[model samples]
Target: MTTSQRWISTAINHALLLGAIELEQTDRGTRPHRLPAAARAQWPDPQLLMVEGQPSGMRLAFRTTATAIELETIPTKRIYVGMPPRPDGVYDLLIDGQLARQGSVSGGDSLTINMSTGSATHERGAPGVLSFEGLPAGDKTIEIWLPHDETTELVDLRTNAPVEPIGTNGAPVWLHHGSSISHGSNATHPTGTWPAVAATAAGVSLINLGFGGSAIVDPFVARTIRDARADLISIKLGINVVNTDAMRLRAFGPAVHGFLDTIREGHKTTPILLMSPIYCPIHEDTPGPTAPDFVDGKLSFKASGDPAEIAMGKLTLNVIRDTLSKIVTQRAATDSNIHYLDGRDLYGEVDSAALPLPDRLHPDGDTHRLMGERFAALAFAPGGALAH
Candidate 1:
């Protein structure tokens, strides 16, 4: 079998298989294209080598703030990445970054990062950040840029390159799911994905389920996430649910209930964080029935679902949240384990200025970095993995 196919098969066979991911063009390539020969030897860890093929021009360097972990085990945390623009068609995995067993690029032809699936990213345009963990646990800078093309120079001045290490645990697993925003569109590389940023800030594992326009509370997705094991977990709802215009009020309630219900079935008591959605001026408080061509200035939208349905208050995020609030309130009574976090809290209107998504949909890497740090502060505590 091809290298990419083998890795996909090993999804079950391999325990360390990446879990969370936000994919674009679900029907794209199974893996990224091959790496430039030189890049192969350099990027060895999966944490860093997110593009396709081999790990050539890639290198690791670091800057520390508090204490450092003596750079051991591929400084997994905060592995930064940046890539030049590419045609919006298909591509392959260039090279293997930090931790790689064996994989390929261009499986589906689409480009994205399956943070949990051990997949590679297909560059959209420009250069952005890529992150790694296992840092020395101080204010550290890390960068990992991969692109075999001759016209790209990836660099990270704000944060240091490579990364120091904290030398703890295995590596935090990050699990995420959302709409196009979460799928790494417009962002430069897999490391630039918000989940990646968040993963770095909080220093935990990631399992991104952020499908480009597919996070409509699919029972299968929930089941998939529930079954996957990880040290941390999160789900970004609202935007996708509302944007897709999936379900009405009645259905939204049950869907949320079922989604969480299934997750609880698997996670039970794993600090499951339920996030709302970020601020998109066009759809902030508006209802859906979202058809294409709805715009509030430069902000253009497709209304997501059926407007008639939204008029009924059945397909709006507000309505969904209200229902979720009620469900969680009640569920919290019995299921104290489940936690609800308003998505607005993460990226509300006020944040629109400081952390603007160049396209105004997803959060940029810097914002993602902030969100991750906040999440770690709120979700994690001193020493232990989860919050008390």
Candidate 2:
């Protein structure tokens, strides 16, 4: 029997939205956000705008009896100015908490970004439709994970049966924040990101604040984390601080303290895990201002700052790790709920040898899986850092 379909707008009441702090309704459609409007207004850097626009941990989840469904979206794909063309961002379909299909939209607008110049150009394209046919009958949970790397605008949703949002029902909420590594940079799909994988393993709802090239210990971001409703909070810091050369040793400690202080205001006794950076061979001993090298149009990062700058207090991965360890230790002495996890425990030298970072910065899909599994084992496992 051919059931009639009805189009529905993407509204908060109709679908469960995770990780996003706000929704920007535009002529194109509604765009989910990780940072609130106030934060965006404060730091209107184009890089922050671009990274936040990408739905790192956003998904549209609902319960439906539909046998067939279609969703229209306008994906703003990013193209690094000099790099080769990249594949379309993937959309993941999950039914009853299992991945059912992986697909990509054929047409969409493009955001051409010049990393060196920190400028962007937009190229218009048509909206793309994603269709799923022959879904299981009866009430079933449906989740469509947005592409982690693209700025996606929800256009419309169509289904043959009625749909409604599903409530959390007391599920533990895990709020996470980090750098591009946690933003699903080189992951295979949206759920394949390390944080997503860990969240699934831990059986907790996730709110990921990982932003590509934008997790620079911003006060507004800390405030965002402070205000979020999370039972468990974990922050993976330091990579972006080194990559952008955003701060020196003099300011790094105080900045981290302030960020933590802000989060502690809302989550007084909530379990907070402070994680250092993962193993990055290039930035381990070398200072950064990471520079990209395009070899045959392939993107790879290299440490551009001098190693000698360490004496001058220029931050490096090692410096950040030491500082984070000290800070967590000092705080844990006063606060039992706070803990520390060395990111090397998640992805260290041995793991890197087995599953190396493809871009000299972000982990590959395999590494993401490994890191996610490892993180779950360490933090969520019994007697672990974040374990209650």
Candidate 3:
């Protein structure tokens, strides 16, 4: 280490961490997890385990007078064996609450998955450093948003000047839960995610629980949200359930009710917005187990289940949306704090025409920004459901 540089222990610097529900000590450092250890212990699905550890909305917040800063981290990057390589997760640095610079680390570890075979292999590599220099003079609040799509283990924080925990800005905390789109699929960086964008615009603190492919209204997830310290809560449903064919119509309604019931037990009268899935042509009326389509070496998705199955209670995006709307409406009769939002309002047919989903599933970076802006306008506006 340089004589002028000092190392900050991430393990002991708990107050500097944000958006993570738990932090587990690792051999090299500490790994931030969106879900608490108790929830993780209940369900051991590999997909859920992986996505929950991705640290979608996690970041480090501190006040420092440093001109140069370096964060040492080991990130686990995921790759699909047959498909094109995914981009390295990007780290966003914010100075005084505005984006100042973006950076990324290379050569940490890789987890290659064979989607067709449902098997994955992990290879370890040395940690890399993300360095930022030439900050504006004087003390300033700094936020280093971690990669939204990668599992990063933070080793140490090095700076040329002293650093201290940043105090909260007195904004309401918005706890959001949803599928991969909300987890930042295809988004260029962590702050680009819709939840982050909306949170920033609405001036609310964000606690994102959007697990990729794992937002199936699990009881454990509901319990976690139930126990969280949130001033406002929003749960986006339907897409993952339809795409995974994880539930039939008969079970979907009760599962959602149960999920809300569990949360209400702890957060009585807390503003809760229940949202449907955004427009996705492939699953709007058709049922899924969506399967990957490799047409001309380009990745896309196709609904593998028969549309006729909907008559027999098979769940489709349309069905799930209708059910969710009805569920929220029913709950609102007694619980005035509960409300419903049609996801189509955020991203509908016009949006689909303008900026199509790049993979016939997830939206691209631009779309995420659009969605975030729309959400902020709708939810934070006067007389809006989430308006104080």
Candidate 4:
């Protein structure tokens, strides 16, 4: 450590953390989790465990006079067995509420997965330091947004000057739950995610519960949302359920109703916006159990379920959207705060033609930005469902 630098352990200062639902005390340091310990314990699927710890909307916020800062973190990066190595997760630094700089940590733990075999291997590596030097002098609010896709355990935080936690700023909190699209798949950075973008534009604090492949309307997830403090709540459904083929029409409707029932148990009159899936040509009409298609060395996804089965209750994007719309309309009769939004309105056929999803499933960086802008306009504008 440098002679002028004062090192601070995140383990001792819990107040500096923001956006995470829980802070897990790890062997290396503290790891932020989007899901609570009890919820995680209830459903310990490996995929859910990894995504919940990725900290999509989590960041470290403090007020400091430091001219430079350094953070040591051990990040668990994911790797596919055959595809090219993914780039290191980007760390975005905001000074006085504006993005000022970006950085990334190099080597750390790696989790290699063989998707075809449904197997993964973890390799431990040394912690890497992310350094941000030569900041503008004087007291300022600083925020370090961690990687949205990586599981990071913060080891140390060091700065050239004294730092103090920046407590709640009295902004309304928006709690959103969805699948990978909201979890930030293929987005360049954490703030680039649609939910983050919408939160910033809407002038609300975000608590993202967007797990990649794990947003299948689990009871525990609904219970977590029931207990959270939120001024606005949105649940983007359909994509994960269709892709995983976890439920059929017979069970999907009641499962969603039950999920909403649990949330209403706590947030009786809070505005709830229920959204369906966006335009994905591959799954729009086809049922899934989506499967990865590494065609000609490039990754893509294809629906594997037969279309004929959809008549027998297999869920498709179209079917799910219709179901969600009907459910919301039926509930809005007695409950005025419940609302429904067609995900296609956010990214419809027109959008698909203009900015096609690079992977036939997840949107690209540009699309993410576009979707965020569209959502902000649709939901946060005056006379909108979530408008204040």
lDDT of each: 0.47, 0.87, 0.90, 0.90
* Candidate 3 residue runs with Cα over 4 Å from true position: 1-12
Model 3: per-residue Cα lDDT over 193-286, one tens digit each: 9999999999888899999999999999999999998999999998999878898999999999999999999999999999999999999989
TM-score versus the correct structure, for each prediction:
0.57, 0.95, 0.97, 0.96
lDDT score for residue 272 of model 2 = 93
Across residues 7-36, which tens digit of lDDT does each residue of candidate 1 receive?
101111012113312211112112222222
State the local distance difference test value for candidate 1.
0.47
Q: Estimate the lDDT of model 2.
A: 0.87
lDDT of 4 by residue, 1-388 (tens): 4666665544325478778888878788887888889998997998999999998988888899888889999988889887788888999999988999998898889999998898999999999999998899999999898999988888888877778886557778899999999999999998999998898899888889999998999999999999988889999999999889999999999999999999999999999999999999999989999998876789989999999998899999999999999999999999999999999988999989999888899998888988999999999899888997
lDDT per residue (tens digit) for residues 115-231 in model 2: 788778999888999888888889998888888888888777777776787755456888999999988889989999999999888888888899999889999999999998888
Cα shift from native, residue 143, model 4 (Å): 1.3
Off by over 4 Å in 1: 1-17, 20-169, 289-311, 354-357, 381-388
Ranking by TM-score: 3, 4, 2, 1
RMSD of each predicted structure: 13.0, 1.8, 1.5, 1.6
